[model samples]
Structures are given as C-alpha cells and as structure tokens.
Target: MNTVQLERMKNDKGFIAALDQSGGSTPKALANYGIAQDAYKDEAEMFQLVHEMRTRIMKSTAFTKEKILAAILFENTMDLKVDGQYSADYLWETKGIVPILKVDKGLADLENGVQLMKPIPNLETLLARAQERHIFGTKMRSVIKEVNEAGIKAIVKQQFEIAKVIIAAGFVPIIEPEVDIHTVNKQAAEDILKKELIEQLKSLTPDQKVMFKLTIPEVDSFYEVLADHPNVVRVVALSGGYSREEANSKLSRNRKLIASFSRALTEGLNANQSDAEFDQMIGQSIQSIYEASIQP
Candidate 1:
C-alpha cells in the first residue's frame, strides 16, 4: 500500500484497538468508533457497519450518493440487516470479519453488496456510476466541445436531470464534465474557447450559476468575453485534464491566484457588484493575493 493508504490502515488499526479497549462486545459500539470487526468473529456487524458508512458517504455529496446507496442495498444485500442468526452471522461474530475490515470500505461494500443490492441513487453508488460514465482523455475533450456547442445551460440541465435520477436511485450524483486539455495545443484550445465558449457564455441567464471544469488557457479568454456580459454571475476555473500530481503542483504554485480569483467572484456576487465594479474588486484581489502568499 501507498503511504496514505498505510496511514489510513494504521489509523483504522488504532481505532480498532481503542474499541477493543473500550469493553464493548456489540457491533454498534465498534461501528460508532469506525472499527470493523473480523468477519469470522462478527460478520453481521461488519456488513451492517459497512452499509451505514457507505450510506453516510453517499448522502454527503452532490453526486454518487443515491446510486451507491442503491447498489449497497440491492447488490450487496446491505439493507437486509442480517438477524445475527445465520452461519455467516456466527462466522462474522467469531472470525470472518477480518477480510471485510482490511479492504477499502467503499470497494468492499461494492464487491460484497453489488450483486444482491438493487441500484439506488446514493452518494457512494453515484460516485461508482460517475467512474463508469467518466469519458477521459480524447473522448472527454470531444464531449466538452459538444456540450459547449450545444450550450452550457443545456448541458447543465441535462447533467442535473441525470443527477436527479441518480439521487432518486439513492445515490448522490457528482456531475462534472471532464475536460481534456492535454490532447490539444494551447492555440487550438483558445480557438475553441473564444469561438465556441464565448458565444455560449453571452447567452447564459443570471440564474444558471454552476461550477464548470475548464482549463487556464480557456479561462483568460472566456473571462475576458464574460467581462462584457451583465448576466454572467461567477466563474470557477478547473484544471481539466491534469493528472492529480500536476493539479496539485499547479494548486501549490498558484494558490494565491486561485484563491484571489475565487474570492473576487464570490464577493462580487455576494455584494451584488456589477461588471462596472471590476476595478474595486481587482484592487481587493491584489491585496488578498499578497496576504495569501505570505501566510505560513
């Protein structure tokens, strides 16, 4: 396992050890402390705790909440609530729970419950659905262009509708369009942004504010065009197509730039400042950036 995973495992081990020290034999007590009992020792409790954690995670996100829940309930038999009478239950109550506890909670839930549980819209399930639907690399870029051309409002509406279905199924739907900037040169990307995206932004209504996944090259031109539009409310720039490492590097290097831009837009919206208020906001951003840069 990687360092992070190892650390998490260590933490989980610590939690389990603490629970053992607490003198509780019931599964609920172990669960409240985020401890997974060995499957052979307490199968029913292990399964139940896994179900509850999955449910909790799913409810907390915009996407993947519903589907994950459904998957857990239907595919994994997660919601069946074993009566603590079956052989599996005795095994789990005894020694069968270790494997269940060691694996990643989410993956274990999916693997164990997916087959028996009916698909539902919940946060964890929806995230799994998103992973299934994620069109990456070249395919993602093409879809972004298609979505932009079709109109962001339309795309937003469609995505929201999908999210609704995902939610209805008991999963939270995370509906972010993947943008692949790595496949195209900067000039080609700029052309797409200026020619296609600018026109789309000009057409948006004030009520349709949603976060968008877009690259930096696209941001400069798109913002420049949007600067003239009175209806556009806010913009959040995303490092689309960047790997986790690259995204992290960019975030560390330009934390101030990112924070300042976000703060300016947020303050402007909160104060109902207009495009004409750009000068004042820009001045505020300079100060915010400087302060953010100096923070330890």
Candidate 2:
C-alpha cells in the first residue's frame, strides 16, 4: 500500500470516476457514446473503441485530481496503454488520480432475489498484475433486486469474502453490492442492506479497511453511519440509472457519500463532438459532482 495514496483516499474531497465498463456493459456503453454496434467487428475492436473513449475522457482538461479522486478500470483496460504510459501509471503520474481495477467476471443468474458475482478464478493473477502496475485498489459488484434477507445476506457475505483475499494481497477493496433502484421495495431493501452491512463489519479486523459503493438511498442521510464507520475507508454512491442531474441532486443530500458515477458521468459525451464541446460537457460534470461530494 502506498501511504500517500491511502492517506489521500481518507482525506480527499473529490468523487471517483467509474470507467470500468466490462464486456457485458461495453456494448451499451459504446452505444451511449454514440458508437453503434455495427461499427466494431469483434470484441477486440469493441474494446479498442471503448478504450479510445476512456482515453479521451481521461485526457480531458476537466478530468484531473482536482475533481476526480480515482478511476476504476476493466481487466482489458489495465493491460492497455494511454499516451505511451500504462493506464494506471498515466492516471497517477499525469492526472494525480488513484487507479482501481474492477475484478468481478460479472453477475450470475438472478438467485433468491439477487444476482451474485460469478466466480473469478483468475483474481490472483489480476491482483498481482494490478499491484505490479501501481494500481491502488480493486472493485467488484453484486446486485440486489428485492427484499429477501437471505439473498441480501448472501450478497454481502460473498463480497466481503472476496474482499478479504484482495486485502491480504495488500490492496483496499471497494465492495459494491448494488441495490437496484427500480425495485419496488427499494427502501425496505436498503434498510436490510444497512443491517446486513453492519453485521458484516463485525467480522473484520482492525487493520482491514474496505470501502463501499452504494446506491443513493430514498431517504437523505440514511447511510451516514456507514460512511463514518471506523472499519470503512470511505463511502461512495453509484448513479444506478439516474440521469446526471438527478444523480447529482440526490448525491448532494447524502453527506459523506461521494459519487462514483459511470453512465451519468459520461451522459452528454459523444464521439461526434468536437474536442472543445467534449471538454466543456465533462468539465461541467466534474464541477457538479465535486461540489456534491464535498457537501456536509
């Protein structure tokens, strides 16, 4: 662990930028960026296109440590280069942004009201490579779609279990058990998640410091306790399916929970826009999210 990066994570007042769209979400992500499916011939070409998009975003004058504290990367992206530097190195050295890797293989079929992450048999290899590349941490996600306690419990359990391995490999883990925003019983599910998360916190040792990326709760300040938990490094909110404006408005109400938006962060960006237009749009997003993140 780099002490400087760890300290920055604890004290930073900026939000994270999620650029880690994996194979499952890449097509939709590309389409949103105004690149159609037929534009790319195969997975390799598709990823190359997405990487270019990500590089453009990363290279933007607005996307620096001044607003973005960190960024998450997909496995393929970690191996790619940006401006002749490895992605993680460029993020840290040029932009002053900490680099995090997304490690899950993606979610399994819905089970017991949730979708758990599929097994990552290659996690050790990924973690080792990330560490070698000067990456700071890792992120993995699972989804909760209902009010089933057993299912929610399982989600939390699986996340924490994987988190331990990541920590032992000498990296902080952002454990994301995303509660689907459109679920009818959203508030009830969040209530149970809070309880389950609190219970899970008890299993960690003093040296273990994990982070959380959660959905903005229906009620304001609902997750303040978790944000302030001693066992946690920090708490962040995912955009889920909200537009940038809606997500920013909701995020400002949740003190101590910063934004880690993906789609919302890049909502107005398009491959067709001129460089000036692209920079202006992303700059506006960075400013809004930065302000909301520092809300007290």
Candidate 3:
C-alpha cells in the first residue's frame, strides 16, 4: 500500500454516497421513476439516462462537499462531463467532494449467498484510467450468505488479495463483504467476518491497508476491532437495501463505521420532481446520513 495515499483517504473519512449502479441496477432505478421500458431500448441510450440521473443528483451541490466526503461512481461516470468539465473535476473544484471509482463488474453466482465479482480483465487498465481522472480511491464488492467458517475465510482472503493489487496501484480499496440481513445467523456471520478480517489484516505487510464497506452488523460492535486496527484506514457501512431511516438508525449505534450507502441514500428521489424538489430530497438525505455517521 502507498502510505501517503492511504493516509490521504483516511483523512477524508465521512459519508460516501454510492452512485455506482450497474447496468442491471440502472434499469430498476429508472423504472422506479416511472420510466417505461420503451424510454431507452439500447444500452447506449440507457447510459444517457444514468448520466441525467447523476446530473439531477448534482443539483444538490450545496450538500455535496459538506455532508459527503466522497462519491463512489460507476465506470461510465468517470468520463462523463458536467458544464464541459469532467464530473470528477467538477465535484472537486466546485463542491470539494473527492471522487472514487467502482471497479468491480456485477456479481457472479457462487453458492447461495456467496458472490464473487464478475471478472474485470482490464482492472489494471481501469485503475490507470481512474488515476488519470484524478479519482482518489476504488471499491469492489462480494457477498456472504451464511456463517460457514470456511466460506467466510475464503471470502476474506480473496478480498484482501484484490486489495493488495489496488493498494499497489496507489489507490485506497474499499473491500465490501455484504452479509445479507435476511440470513438467520446474522450475528454469527458477523462474528466470523470480524475474526477473519482481523486475521487477514494481521497477515498483510504493515503498509497494506484497506477501507471497508460492510453491512451494518447484527451486533453493533462486531466490527469495532477492525475499526481500530492499524492496517485499516476506515470502516464504513453499506446500507444493504435498508430504508434510509432504517439505515440511519442502525448506523448510529456503531462508532467509527460511517455511511457509504447506495440505495438508501437515493430513496424517495424520483425523476418527476422539479429541480428544487429534487435538490430538497437529496439534500435532506445527505443531512440524515451525515448526522448518522457522526453520532457518538
């Protein structure tokens, strides 16, 4: 890990709003706003809608720099322009918000809930592109379905293995291992996750640090160990499909694990709203999430 870059990321810790919806998720989001299937038949046209969606979100610029430390963007967004300037540069220059890139492809089917990221043959090239765009970090995701000890170990090991590559490329890696909230053994799964994460961090070289975006655990302090670990730069929580209010409530119970929410952060926003209304909804969301992250 590059200590300088890792420390830079640690210094910017706060709520990270995730705008990294994939091709699969984009259609679902557009549909929620009453967008018809005929609205955009092709992938290229759909990408424009995604760009519009992000532009609409950016109208709430007043809240971006203050409440959000960074924005996690999809690959398509990395090269997008706003007012003739690149979106990443616009965010930093106009709103003081750092930009992070989501590097993983969508999930692959593994066992029931265990997920592996879809392979990205050009990951190194992607990281190089992110650097060129001045993005500050990168995030990738995996999932855990149940509390099988062996499965948890394998997941943690693989995440760290990828993190090594990310760190070597001079970017902070947000390693996400989402534990499905519906799992019956939620607490047990978190316990295993905590142990495995700590053991893996112990095995890493001293400078190899990674950020975490975990589901809010059943036990509030289940991740407290990593939150304080030297090899961990930051520990943030994923909303994991929770309602905004629900996510805020759960996240408030934990110290150090702040918000890095996706769905919950965009809840209640719709394409039909006027610019003022849209800004109001998103601004309110940033406020709620920001407050939850700093709760002591």
Candidate 4:
C-alpha cells in the first residue's frame, strides 16, 4: 500500500458510522420515520436529506475523532458539499473523520435468505469517481443468512474478487459478509465464515490488506482468527436488525471487533426532531457504540 492508503487503513477502523442507504434501505428508513415516500420527490432530494443528517450529526461536539474513525456514504452523497468544501474534505479538515463510499449496487437473488451484491458493470468508473472526490475507502456487503456451504464459499469468493479490485485502485475495501442474527444455525455459519475468510486472507501476498465488517458472532472470540491476521487492519461489526441495546451487548462480547452500525446507530433519531433533539439522540447512540468498541 502507498502512504495515503496505509494511513487511511489506520484511520478507517473503529466505531465507524454507516450512512450508506441505497434505494433498498432508504425507503424503509424514510417510512419508519413517518416521512412519506413521495416527500423527497426525487433522488436529489433524498441525497440532500442524507447529507443534511450527516452534517447535523458530524457537527456535534460529542461526535469527534475519538468516537468515529470514518463514515461510509452512499454514492450520491460522496461529492455533495457540507460547507464551501466537498463533504469528504469538510469532514477531514474539520473533524478528522475519513469518508468511505458504498460501492455495491444492491443485492441479487436470495437463497435461504443469503444474497449476493448485484454486479457493477462500471465499478472502475465508480472507483475513479470516489478517488477523484478524495474518498478514503469503500465498503460492499453480501449476506450469509443461512449455512449453505456453497453459498458461503461463493460469497467469500465474490467479496475477495471485488476486494482485490478495490485494493489495486488504492482504496481500503471493507468486505462485509453479514450473517443474520436470527438464523437458526448462526454459530455453525459463523464457523464457516471465519474459516473461509481466513483462507482468503492467507491467499493474499504480504503487501495485500483489507478490513472485515461482519455480524457480531454468537461466540465471543469466533473472529479472533481474522483479527490476529497481519493482512486485516481491523474488524468491525454490523448490528443486523438488533436494537441498539442488543447490538451493544453482543458487540461488547468480542474484544477484537468495533462497530460500523447503521440502524442501531441511528435509532431514536427521526426527521421530525428539533436540532437539539437530533444532536442529543445521535450523541447518545455514538456514546453507547463507542463504549462497546473500547471495552476492556
């Protein structure tokens, strides 16, 4: 890795705040907050709302470098302006927060609830755009909702393929193969995921590196293998569908993992909230997740 990439890898770990809501997630979130689907009117307005929320949260005194290492942004918000400067620039210059882009198009067909990210035919273009905008890294996700062995292997292979592309493009890739919290064979699936992930890491040449973002496993130390691997700069946890309290309790069990939570991090925040209420809600969420990440 070059100096910039190496430094970004260092800055891109720990209690990351995920705001990369694609069409698949955005509508559901807007609905949950009682914002009508038509309220945004179009994609531009939707992107504006996301940027507005991020600006509000990042401007808080409580939301500082010590609490959040980076924020993963959806494609539309990557180049948006926070002040006179671009969003990434403002975050870095003002708050020491690295900006990462969400590169996955969306999910494809499902099998036993396991799904692959839809292919991006113009991934190279997107990577160039992210780099042009000074994005520090990128994240992509696939699912392991069940213990289908072939499905598990396919997800691992696909993520590694994309990960290689991201690394070659001079960006740290956050490879997320998330297992559902409600899956029946959760422990077994975690074992499979850990094994496959470790095998993939072993295949990399000495200089190759990437980060792993995974569901907090049932076993407290299930992901220690990856955490200890030289190629893995950090390991972060997703909240799945768990509430904030539940996510925090489970995430605290794993000494190696920190958070990159979405819904759990945004819980109790709503579009209707006043500025003070918005800051207070997001501040509390950041504190809770930060405490879990730094647990002894």
Question: TM per model?
Answer: 0.29, 0.99, 0.94, 0.94
The per-residue C-alpha lDDT of model 2 at residue 270 equals: 95
Off-target runs (Cα >4 Å) in candidate 4 are 1-14
Model 2, span 1-296: residue lDDT tens:
98898888989889999999999899999999999999999999999999999999999989989899999999899999999999999999999999999999999999999999999997898889998998899999999998999999999999999999999999999999999999888999999999999999999999999999999999998999998899899999999999989999999998789999999999989999999999999999899988888998
Error of 1 at 40 (Å): 16
The candidate maximizing TM-score is: 2
Candidate 2: C-alpha lDDT: 0.94
lDDT of 1 by residue, 1-296 (tens): 12232223212211100001111223543343346455426555564554443333222222121111111122232213333432223213332221011001111112211111122335445344333322010000112333233343433344444434433442222233333454345445345444544544444445332222234443333333442344322222344434333433443343112221221211221113343454354334334333332222
Q: Write the per-residue lDDT of candidate 3 for residues 36-130, one digit (tens) a residue.
A: 66999899999889788887786575456667887888999989987777888777777777788899887888764477677778889999888
lDDT score of model 3?
Answer: 0.82
Predicted structure 3, TM vs. truth: 0.94
After best superposition, candidate 3 residue 262: deviation in angstroms? 1.1
Q: After superposition, how far is residue 40 of candidate 3 from its true place, in Å?
A: 0.8
The CA-based lDDT of model 1 is what? 0.30
Query: Sorted by lDDT, highest first, which candidate order results?
Result: 2, 4, 3, 1
> In angstroms, how far off is 155's CA in candidate 2?
0.3
